[model samples]
Target: MTHKIAVTSAFGVESVTKKELKNLGVRDPKAIDGSFVFDGTMRDVSRLNVFLRTGDRVHLVLKEFPARSFDELFDGVKSVPFSDYLPTDARIIVNGKSVKSTLYSLSDCQKIIKKAILSRLSEDKRTTYFPESGPTYEVLFSIRNDLVTLSLNTSGKGLHKRGYRDLVGDAPIKETLAAALVALSPIDAERPFVDPFCGSGTLLIEAATAAMHIAPGISRDFDFLHWNFFDKKLYEETIEEAKSGEKKQKLPFAGYDVDPSAIKLALRHAERAGIREYVHLQARDVKDLSHAKSHGCIVTNPPYGERLLTEREALELYKTFGDVCKRLDQWSINVITSAKGFERAFGKKADRNRKLFNANKECRFYQYDRL
Candidate 1:
């Protein structure tokens, strides 16, 4: 059966998510704010969960309607055929967010939506109490301008939890955002890639996975796998397809960090990601970074003077980065940071800059083309 599907992305990477959806054969995906919506079947659901690298989560859209009151919200939620997707023993959890909506109490909206779902499902089961001992179904709601959109979460944990990083450094970039940054850059198999401040190696790992066409979700389990409506064989076939598509050749990629602990953790993560042999991680400061490669790409999430370094130190580091960039004239540089005066500190204007959010921190991805 065909269902409306929505994939949530980081605030500024909706276009990347939509591009990925289209590449996955989703025709004309509609880009809403922070998400992409499309119509697909069970196979599409499995494929998306397995293949989407930059999305936060895949959700099955249930309904969309105007909800200005508690009564309207209740009726709107209760109108969905919950029994068709959720089993009798399934546990239900409601999460909600409201923006510019009359039904603004998020807590009240969640409680009412849960009650409505229970009320509807209990009627079908001819029981008042539902012993929810089975798998979980997370119901998500977003209200914007008095219109409520309801969906079921198909990803349990956010997609950034790729099940590889057992340890993380301070201010580690989210894997979804890292993958998005890599996608935005001009890195390919031929071009070498480097992340000088490779905190926990998220950027390098994501870059390697993308260059090799490895699915980000290949090593983890999703919420839909436990659902009653999921097609297990189809999902297995998709996994096999992803495995078969893995590129065997190792790309030229390296990561360096001043923190030895971060480098060790990055190595461990790379090992867990099954790309340890492909990624060369080392403990080196940004000032001492040097490469023999003439032309390559440097994509890194550097210190933003917020958590790890002071403003003065961050500026000094950017200056050092600027000096390093001047030496590597054949390389392109892409740095994401929350530093306000990054260009001024770096002593050069960026060829292009894009605003992105790195875990709620507003950041600018400054790109300097090869010069």
Candidate 2:
């Protein structure tokens, strides 16, 4: 059955909408605030679990309604044909969000719905166990102005957990965001891509993976694996297809850092992910990244003075960063930073700027296109 599935994306970031869905073979995708809505089957869910790289989570929104009180919430949940989805002993968890609604406490709202579901199941099906011992349904409640929107989390764990990076350095960029940045940036595998301050090799790995058409979830497992409706034959078919689809492509991407320990971790992670052959690792300073190429792209998340160094050292780093970009005049540059006066220190105006949150810190994506 074709169903309306809502994919949870990074809040306030629109770059991962249609492109991400397309990468996962999801057709006719619609972009929504902090989410993407699409139509697919249980088999497609298996593909998403293995291939999607930019979304935080993927949810299947069951229903939305106006509920002013606890009774209304109960009625709304019981309205759905839960007998078809939830087994007699299935566990249930409620994760919710509220904005300007009569439902003040999330716990209270969850308890009421649970009671209603238990009552309906026990009375109609004569099932005593409220939560059976199989899969789980994480229902989300979004209450706004006395209205409730309930949805089931298909992807139990966040998509960012690609299950490859066993080692991460200080101030590591999320794999999802790194992949999104690579997709939105001007970097192409035809030339070379460099991340001078690439901690944990996220940007480089994402670039190499994109170039080779390797499935992001190749070594990862997801929550949908434990769902009652999950089909093993269909899931295995998807995995085999993904494996067959991978092709050898040129990925001249490299990562460099001053910390040898960080470089060691990145190398180990790439080895574990089975993509070390496609990436080159080095321990070097940002100042050494001068004039690598004129037509490629230079992207990095440099030291932001958080746990690395002082404000003065960060400023000097930015100054040197400006020099590197200026020297490599033919390369388009895209940087993600939270440093104050970044553009000013770089001595160049960005062609485009996008505001996004990195680890809850407001940051910007500064882009410079060499025209």
Candidate 3:
């Protein structure tokens, strides 16, 4: 059966996510508010959940309609064939969000949707008391301008939860944003890749995964795995196909943090990410950050704001790091930060910059090329 699918992502990374979907052979893929939406098969669903690096979640769009009234909402939701997607005893969890709609009560919307789904399933199962002993089915509904869009989550967790990094530093970047930062740059997979302010080595781990053609969700468990209509054999075959394309070898990447504890965590995290011996993790200050190789790349998330360092100290570190990077004239320097007056403090303007959101804070990804 064909399903309307949505590969959701964070803000300002639509282009990167779109290119990734297109490369996976999704034709004429369209982005709607930072999400890739398309009508695809179960294979497409399984393949995307297993390979997307920047996507947040893979959702099956069940239905969409206008519902300004409670009756309209109930009727619209009840019209869908819940039994087709969910089993007789499926445990249903409904989540709702209402924005600029007449039915603004999120709790009311969730309850009504759940009631409607149960009513729909009762007719097919011919029972009133559903044991709910079967697999899980997470339903999500969003109402914006009186329009309700309903979907089921196929991914069990956010794609950023790559099952690595048991610990974190005071300030850590999300894996999704880390991979997006690496994707926005031009880096040679064989050359040296470095992160100076590597809190827990997320950037280096994600970078190594990308450079080596590693499937981000190769070992992840998805919600679709427990669904009745899902093709289990097809999913297994898809994983095998993905495994065949992997480029498994030692990767060239490095991460350095001034805090020795952070370095210890980076080492453990790298081991969890299956890249322990392949990459370098060390305790070193930004002043001592250097690489002997030319044509390398520097992708880092420096200390910014009041989390790890004060504003004044962050600016001073940027200036000092800028002077240090000047020596690597043939390398590329990319920094993501919420620091104020970053370009001016760095004593050099970035060749280009892009807006990105990190931890719900407005940040800029400043890209400077010395090559």
Candidate 4:
């Protein structure tokens, strides 16, 4: 059966996630807000959970209806055949969000939805008690403009949890954001890539994996894996196909950090990410940022005086980094930071900049091309 699928991401990453979906064979997908909506089969669901790089989570849309009151909400939720997707003993967890809707109490909506599901399940099983000892199933509900959408979370944890990077720096970027930065940058298999202020090597590792055609979700488990109705064979096949697509050749990717401990952590993360050989990590200050090869790309997330350094120190570092960039000609220097007057400190106006959020911290991604 064809299912309506929704892939969500950060607000500014719609284009990246949409391109990823299109490459994965989703045709003419429509995006609303931070979600990309499309129609696909169960196999598509499995593939999306395995191959999506920039998506935050994948949801299989179960129902959509207008519900301005609690009664309407409960009835709309109870109408869906919960038995078809949830087992009698499944631990159902309801997550809810409301915006411009009459049913504004999130807790009330969750309780009602959970009760409706329980009523449906008990009626279908002819029982009043449940052990709730089975696998967990999370149901997400969103009420926007009095329209409710209920979806099953196929990705239990967010996709950014790539099962790596047990440690982080003061202001570490998410793996999803790092992948988006890599996509937006000009780094490719042919060009060298470096992250001068590398914190745990997320950017370098993401760039290496992308160049090598590795799926970020290849080795991670998804919520759908434990579902009773999921096509197990198709999921296993998807894993096999994903492994087959990975490139074995190492690329010219390097990362440096002023903190030796951060470098060590980055090395461990790269090893955990299974791309240790593809990435080189060393303890070095940004003042010494240099690459032997020309025309290489520098994509980094530097400190912005918000977490790690003082405002004066961060501005000085930006000036130093800008000076370093001037030495490396014909290369693209892309940076993401929350510091104000970044262009003034960086010594010049960026060719272009895009607004992005790093962990809800408003920031700008400045892009500079050539010397």
Q: How close to the true structure is residue 275 of candidate 1, measured as C-alpha lDDT?
A: 92
Q: Candidate 2 has what TM-score? A: 0.93
lDDT of each: 0.90, 0.79, 0.88, 0.90
Query: Could you give me the TM-score of model 1 versus the true structure?
Result: 0.96
Which ten contiguous residues of candidate 4 have the minimum total lDDT?
Answer: 163-172
Q: Tell me which of candidates 1 and 2 scores higher on lDDT.
A: 1
Provide the RMSD of all predictions against the true structure, rounded to 1 decimal: 1.4, 2.1, 1.2, 0.9
Give the residue spans of candidate 4 off by over 4 A.
none
Regions of model 3 farther than 4 Å from truth = none
Per-candidate count of clashing residue pairs (backbone under 3 Å): 0, 4, 0, 0
Give each model a TM-score. 0.96, 0.93, 0.97, 0.98
Candidate 3 versus the native: TM-score?
0.97
Query: Which tens-of-lDDT digit does each residue in 1-371 have in candidate 3?
Result: 78899999899788898899999878887787557799898999999988889999999999999999999999999999998888878989998688898999989999999999999999877889888898889999989899999999999788888888667676889998999999998775788889999988999989988887888888778889999899799799888987888776776789999999999998888888777888888999999877888778999999885687789999999988888888787889999999868998888999999999999989999998772
Candidate 1: pairs in clash: none
RMSD value for candidate 1 = 1.4
lDDT of 2 by residue, 1-371 (tens): 87678877775466564677786678877875567788888887777777887777777777789988788889998887666666777788887878899887988988887777677677778868664576777777778888787777777768777777876688998888888888878766688888899888888888888778888887776666776666788778988998898986657788999899989988987887778987789999888886455678877898887768777788789888898777788888888988877888888889998887788888888988862
* Model 1 regions more than 4 Å off: none
Candidate 2: minimum summed lDDT over ten consecutive residues — where?
11-20
Q: What C-alpha lDDT, on a 0 to 100 scale, does residue 47 get in candidate 2?
A: 79
